[model samples]
Target: MSQRPRLHAPTKRLDIQGLRAVAVVLVVAEHVFAQPIGGFVGVDVFFVISGFLITSLLLAEHSRTGRISLTAFYWRRVRRLMPAAVVVIAATLAAVLLLVPQRAPQSLADAGWSLVFLANWRFADQQTDYFAADGPVSPFQHFWSLSVEEQFYLVVPVLLVTTLAIGRRSSPRVVALSTLSVGVVASAVLAPIQSTADPETAYFSTPVRAWELGVGSLLAFGTAIWGRLPAWFGTSLSWTGLVGILVSAVCITGQGAFPFPAAAAPVISAAMVLVGGVRGPTSGAAVLRAGPLVSIGNVSYSLYLWHFPLFIVIGAVDPSAVWWTVPLSIALAYVSYHLIERPCSVAPLAMWHRRERARFREALRPQRRSVQVSAIGLAAVTAVVLSLVATDRVRPIDIPTVPLAADATAAPTVGGEDRPALAALGKGIVDALSATSWPELDDGPGANLVGTQHPECGRLSPAPSAETCTFGSPTAERSLMLVGDSTAVHWIDAYLRLQDDGLLAGWRIVTRTAFGCPFIDASLGGQDATECASFRADTLDRITEVEPDVLVITNTFADTGVDGDGTAPGAAEWAAATQRYVVDVRESVGKVVLVSPPPAGQSVQNCYSVGGSPSACITETSSAWRSRLAALNAVAGDDATVVDSRPLFCTADTCPAFVERTIVKKDFVHLTSAYARKSAPALGELLRSRSVFEDTLVGH
Candidate 1:
């Protein structure tokens, strides 16, 4: 009798099917429930299972026939996976064009990638780009995992065949075992390193993920040795593994180190379950073989293909109806399981597998080299043509954003009578939610005109030579400094415009800004905390030495501990740190203007398209922010000019993406430089009105 259990026999093996069911449920719950389940490791479980099962099948075939048939393997894959996949892709594209025409382009691009089984690469590239990956999401995002699997399938067979050829005298099992061991080690080491450097890219990269599969393959190769363990041992291992998977799914989080340490919980647990099932049915096996789980597993492939699109479309159409998508997805999957999966893959595949020996000689037939060369040449030509025609990357004509009038050389100062009408800003919330299209803004410096401007004075890390970042009248003895984080940098354009309008003819302007470091006395916990700390130290010393006429503080209040003490935000923390900083700086400066961060709600980046209205992205102001602003004012203690900026970006109940003709924000939090420039008149008026700068000053 064969030492290894029959991996392919349905009657004998329902536990594997049950495991698949558990994996799919975990993945679906994470997506549909909006809770922290850490269920993404379910994909890792699938990878391990694939590695083990495919290895078992391949090695078994080689043992029985002395050779593997590439033709049969690839054809069987096509029959099993492609039919359902193609139908879903086509249907999703059609649905996007029909029901949600605004999203059709995203759907179409996703379809092309999915069709070629290269969705992972497409997503990886897009996800790495800050602009492309920010807000717009694809319905076919889940297809990336399928793409990784298909790529694995294409390469693994070739790897096995090549390794077998290299060690002709060695047993096929030995060659597979040795080759997979090295791959597991190499991939395990690379995954965490790459994940730390660029987590999104590492998430999709095949090389980084190969280790998960290698673990399963190693288990499969050793099945002969392990399959003979006692029933009691198998039972104990089975329960332990099931509990491990459940606990990991409940407790592990995706925000930390990831796939390496946390993923081991599920991967090792899955292997244990698989091994424990090799003998008589263990208690773990009995639980996994439950009817509902086995049934879900039977249709799991189709269910996965259907659920994501249904969830996305439903959420878009009516968020209230989104909960129903899962049930509908299962219904559709059941139908698809009956019609497409069984007819195309299951029923005919049994007959094909039975007759594979008869077609061995035909499978070995080689194709002509000329055909291969011609095909490759055509593909290269097509790629070149596509790249050139992708001029959509260039700025589109008729951009939704209004540019400055040609005659307007500088920001026109506006006050009481000249303030533009706020009631008639970007599209209304009602119109916005149902918008079909909007302008696609160019995503270069145009989008980041303010935040990315004046990097010498304002950046992510400490700049030793920032002493040289003085912008206006460098030789003037009287100085002004912009202080705080990237938010403080937002006002650089307004100040520059002030100098242009000859408001500060002789006073020099200096900047002490870093991306995340605010002029507050507290610790921050983010990737750039160290750099921010260094910059904070450098700027603190610089500010006291320069002792400028005005010290402007600007930073987002979203970070909690920034309340002054390194304590949680509450009744005590609200303005403690901020007020303390402002009070201390007052001793060495003329006046301090504490500019509050402008009101920003949800991102409007993906809320509309080229034909859509900006109004569709309208959102409500946060009461918490209003409370924070009030706390800052309460703590000002007569030393600072506390400017509430909500009037510039918000109405009583609504906030807008655009004000007048200028886009108010580039991303969710920061403003466009154009809006800052437009607001120059108001900002200068506010500073002058507050008497922060002496009425008769240098350059006045």
Candidate 2:
């Protein structure tokens, strides 16, 4: 619609503009629509383009003047980037304050960090939690890429200057390429390892991503050396490059290792497109220089800036209206380019050395000073708003004590109103923070509950055979084995304390837990499915070898391949798996206890940190768990003793997250150590009733 930006002179390399359009579109599509395309690689494409264009400009400047002007370069970067960034960030913070007060504190902090270009480090330190997916997307989260590029812009100039200064005998290109090559190789080497060890940290860290930008800088050297190539070669290279990029988008998903070899496809392919742009006016060049693509490319920067916040805001208002995100983003990008970007970036150049008289003499003069005052006012208002949000606090709900029933192991009744006492406790916690509470939670949603105290032993996925942790006496007359995943870890401390106190004098306990790997006969869904099957087999063998008098089976509903509904297609298969495990275990162990998992609640830790009352995170029932338990019952038959955990964790209609002033679950589903210890009496009593520990004398 609007004319292509004249500042960069489009005809010089119109294809780069087309690439920009493609990159921004990919990013927007992925974020807004959750497309299967690995559109995240779009940022890597931007990194390469930035490396090439900026290096090309710096080299050109050095060739002309024999040195780079650091002041001019930085000023231009700030001039081009900062104005629009400030506007978008301020607006995003303001929107958060108005719409999602619960996220206000976090959004304010993110904005503050983003302003200084430290968002990537901040997110890395936070570990960028996956559980927070249920919450509103942070509007400023996309600034991590901007922070990376800004960091690159800061370091590269100094690196080139130092390298050239030290290697006076060598050509500038040689020194530049050598410096960039070293960074590329070192970072490339580290990406895969770091990605495997800590993917969240690896994804956000500067060093891991530096190689991507370095690869682009190296491409500049190649371009300089080769100059223009044949037209036919350029066309073929462009087509192949496009195909490679498309393949990467189609093939790559966000599971497993990323940003190392997987990212190489898009990055190298983008490089190909850049290289092919050398000899212009070919068929491929014609496609890139087309009017529509050129227009989008011209405003690609604004598109990138506006899209994320717009998508977040749309979701905040009405999650179902995701369709509005793309069209509105394009419209806003166009408006932002014309109204803010063009005037701020270009007018300063026009007015750089003008006399005050010239402006006074003009008939239709630009109100540059008014615009400055308005911008400053907006910034000041944003600061004040964020300050209020950051400092806001809500009073925590007063806890009401309820005595733990000595017979808490009583069987829960089916489909009835919550017993009065449990209902009261749930109401108190839910009312802790009012619906209109300020500044949200400090910690984050339910991360604590997902973690275990003995993380070293219990948190492994497909844990090694030697990963077992033993409690109680090795020479005890009776043995008990607790096996499954993290869900079983919650009950461990309780059992260990019982053994420590000598309640069961002749009993030994062994626990084998692998997070996400319930001892099922069936394979799991993700990349580690086969490995989990192997773990299930290994754990079964361990159970048989120990030949424990009693075996406890516990796992979350997620193990059944049913996320919400228990009656999903895979329920029968899960039941069969449970039955298979049960049949195998019955042969070795005298008794088996199939522990029904606790009801899944909202992140209580997150709720507490967010100033939520107990009720906010507390729920009445874990329907999903109920469905899974039913599935387990259908196939488990009479071989195993079903230890229904409802009475221990819930009170008929309501499941309370807190009991006797202690937080029951650290996160959504895992029990805290203190809560586990408190539950030992009930669990110990239940086991005795089932004859699991009837032979042993129980004394304090």
Candidate 3:
């Protein structure tokens, strides 16, 4: 009666479900076991499959009706995805609040973004920021891929429908193929370039990932040609596809540029299987359709949703409990599919096919369905709010107030025993964590110390002249120049305190520092490396011009691994640079004082924020310090004084992150204002005793 071909109901493809199972397994195995580097390619496999299936369905619908219903398409997506997603997010939020309260706010923010399908953009922003790079991983980080998929799906139907409607003279298949090809080619061309430049952002972005989906759409449109291929040829294609997936899973890792040529292995391979097995079974298809594989694939969406948060929670408790999490995730996924996904899928399907008013009245029942969906969504929101309220209070930690002794003024010299005051502070740190209640350290001071007091003086990308700030005895006749990166900036508080104490009476201290740059001439490449090198050259020239009475230089001097060559500087290279710098300084500056790097410790803000004990954050100065000392000591002539800061920050084998109520490093390596200022007396005494300024009067 109608001009449309009689379309058979879409049959369940056991092979596709098996592919889903394989993808989920690969993802779960990669995440849980930290092996089979290509396990992440499973995401690519899923993307391609989604593209093919969605395109095929849309094409089939258009052929039957001559037009596609946008309302039905979007409603189907909502019913199929939203219910399970909402429940899982709500549950994961509750779990995060209870177990990892430190990450509650971040998790809530991620969940909010995910609800609106913008999680990918959020992660992309975070990846671009160097400062936020080192923050702890969020359990919901995997939602980025879902966000990308959702955004792609949202645009594809609209694009295809518009093209089909506007170009009535062109064949629908041709129009769809042309539109999809542009997206595929454009994305393919851009992906490698973006991946090379900023792989972190490229990996999480939607535009860069569009090619994989577009390729799958191409396959769907080309089905007529592929359906006529020989069975033996199909078998070969299937085998090759399976092998490609397996090889990629084994070989690819997170270390290198990704989601381009590497991701192509999985995307193309999955496409081969889809195209090759269109009309008949191949060996790959047979394997995929196995009962065990199909069972897992049947609920792969829910499985993907549940696994990551479970991994994060279980990992926090026992990092090696992947055996438990993997199985638990599978079981929970099965339960979720039965309880939520299966029931939610029915309404969308039932309401999808209504040609007339009577049919719509009989079948749709739209108002009732809307009410039910809204109720479920509201319940999810209420549950999330409850979880947030339950964990609203910050866990309190007892910060021990270690009393400074009457003889706290004693400063330890090189190779001399550590001051008794430092020893007392170490004891207090150990005692503070010994209590039964493991509460978070109140980080009000440490949190505000970095930006509020120091501002952008040592941020990643800094303008040299703008970041340069004056410190001690500004109008004094003698000027002391502090030079290096953040490590140098850390000592500024101490310099200011010494000025107040008149330990630096005649000296006006000028701090010239950048974020991650050392004082050495050799390139230490990072995001800030070029600017740092430029700033370093300018600062050195300034030293020559100012010819300050004291040129005190210091830096972490640690190998920053983000180089253009992809290799960080070793000790030998560092030593060579140090020697070169010292030699240059001797020719220009009147007095060159090299301040040794402070004993490194874990991030005090992170440790305290996570409710970790002070003792847990303690670290020993590594043997690397000895090598650094050897290099600096080699270059030290009578004209240069090398001051070792280990005794000031550590006692023998142990280094505490906190001294009294003063938190040491705000992050991992930079010193906090309070601790830096408190250690000024020792630094002041060192500079006063060993330098040409030794004869200078000690202020009252």
Candidate 4:
């Protein structure tokens, strides 16, 4: 092996390096090899290690000299972390353009946040963002952990400096110990509390996660205890700690989420190993110090940085080769560590004033060009960001051209393969298999035209001007109210066109759609379910007030889970709730129309390219989603109008992304506005036949 990095100098512990190797490998198994080992806990292990190392280094500096030099501390941190991070982020940005064009905007923002050490904040918001449903995971997603550590590096050193200065007469060790103990306990307590409100906050919040690092710092502070311990006892404790880390990785699955009680397992386990190692090699140090393990540890940071992007890009370009990405990621990591990480971080912080007894003043060698180099790096990142802004129109999905004619609406029914729109869509999917580029949209993926009705459609607060949402005719005596999630909103363009074709010349259309808020009264274990439950309650109240002649409801239940768990299949609970909700809507407005979600299709960004089988992309059978639809219909019984949407969008078992010139869906599931509008006649005819227009007919 090429000479291992000598960065750790005298303080280097083989066990710690081994732990890094173990942590990184577990993470790779989860992300690249699809293993269930709580590989994510590897990050928790890293946090503990970082906390231990950084805090020890700072305290040693204070002990050697009367004061700590802030400039020296920050400069070392910049050298160790920033250069490699920037290179990886830049490479990730380039990868986004080549593999997944649509994710470019999100990736750039992710890169920007990563550079500033605020990536945790950006991702926490994204998890709860109702509108950001377009892309796959960001390539720079792993940077959130690096961001938190960077944040730790910034605050902890300053904290030590200030606390030591104020309590000059008091024991510095005691003051440090007390202050950090309080911080650790406070952060540990806050984690579960934050998780109940929002798991993302618990997962990514710096304050909530401080305890993991705090444990490591406390271990460093308690170094005096290690010297007094009997050798055999210390070795036993080390062995137990090694076992604990393994148990943590194997046991802690996503039963809830992270950064709480579950995270404690790895954090404590890491501390145990480090504390045990302070005594001697009697611990599991012999195994940890193995050549292959130490080599992996040496390049661990580079491995962590390279693995995620490789996993994502390989999946996009040639999914068949995804299994082999591990070797590729490790090879790249080795190269990056040698070429970039080692070279940039040649000046180790641990090499503190080898010759001088007068430490702080003598060691303060000011490098004049450091600030200028930082400024230049910042400018380069900013330039790339601005370039992305300039080319904003180079997107994954383009503004659709409405191709379906005005009279093209056809309500889908079983065995309606001959229907003009349905047949065209079937053929489009076939042609798309070998065709490159986006399909020229005929009807939708249309831009929102009736903006007032849909403004902030996914919030608890309904639009104040709900009355202005009326379409077709001014002073129309009858009305149709559209309600539910974005699934319902996607069909608005079609309904508006139904009126334009003079099917309902005097009907006023009202919209009560919320973004991710399905029309269920109870919260499922889905993302933002509690908030969505509130939105559902508010919209239900408005439904009674508006009392449209007929209320149209649509939402995708694939994300939903029953027993208040989004991960579990709702099955009975889902259908039961839909049945009850529809009956309640009927009580308020006397009519309920259920437009079940269409089958999931391959996203337009992939599978719609040349030389790919439509079957390869659109392989998920409708039965998976339709099971929920069937449950909903079973509960509704004869009381509500059940629109079997399969006939409209599918020809047999397959659902195509495109039909003729019409794009069936703008995203993974929602219909294109043009297709919605083009299919208006069919939907109108079905609704009319089901007595939806029984009361609101304009007999002029």
Q: Model 2 off-target regions past 4 Å?
A: 1-11, 129-138, 163-170, 224-227, 281-292, 310-328, 347-413, 416-482, 488-517, 520-552, 556-583, 590-700
Tens digit per residue, CA lDDT, model 1, 425-521: 2233223223333434333212233554565666665373755677776577677788887677777877877777745657788888776577777
* Model 2 superposed RMSD (Cα): 8.9
Better of 3 and 4 by lDDT: 3
1-700 per-residue lDDT for model 2 (tens digits): 2222243333578888888888888888888777735887788889888988988888778778888888989887887888888999988887766655666788899999899889989888988842134233468888898899889889998888787777767676677778778888999999998876777888887889888888778877676444467777877887788777777777776554667767889999988888888665443546777789888998899889988987776454433344666766676676667567765564344353445324422412344544455455545644653353334322233332342344333335322142443344344333432333433332233333334556655755536444347766677767778888778877788778778664555578888877767776665654346667677777888887888877888877653432222122355666677778888767787678788777776545333333323344445564456666777777666787777776566654356556655566766677777767766656666565556655322221
Top-down lDDT ranking: 3, 2, 4, 1
Question: 342, model 1: CA deviation in Å?
Answer: 3.7
lDDT of 1 at 311: 74
Instruction: Give a tens-digit lDDT track for model 4, residues 75-193.
Output: 88888788888888888888677656656776788889989889889988867321123435567778888999988878888888987777679787788778878888999889988
> 225-292, model 3: which lDDT tens digit per residue?
88788878876887689778888899775444577767888888999888777865543457887889
Best prediction by TM-score: 4
Best by lDDT: 3
Ranking by TM-score: 4, 1, 3, 2
* Cα distance off (Å), candidate 3, residue 644: 6.9
lDDT pick, better of 2 and 3: 3
RMSD of each: 11.0, 8.9, 8.6, 9.3
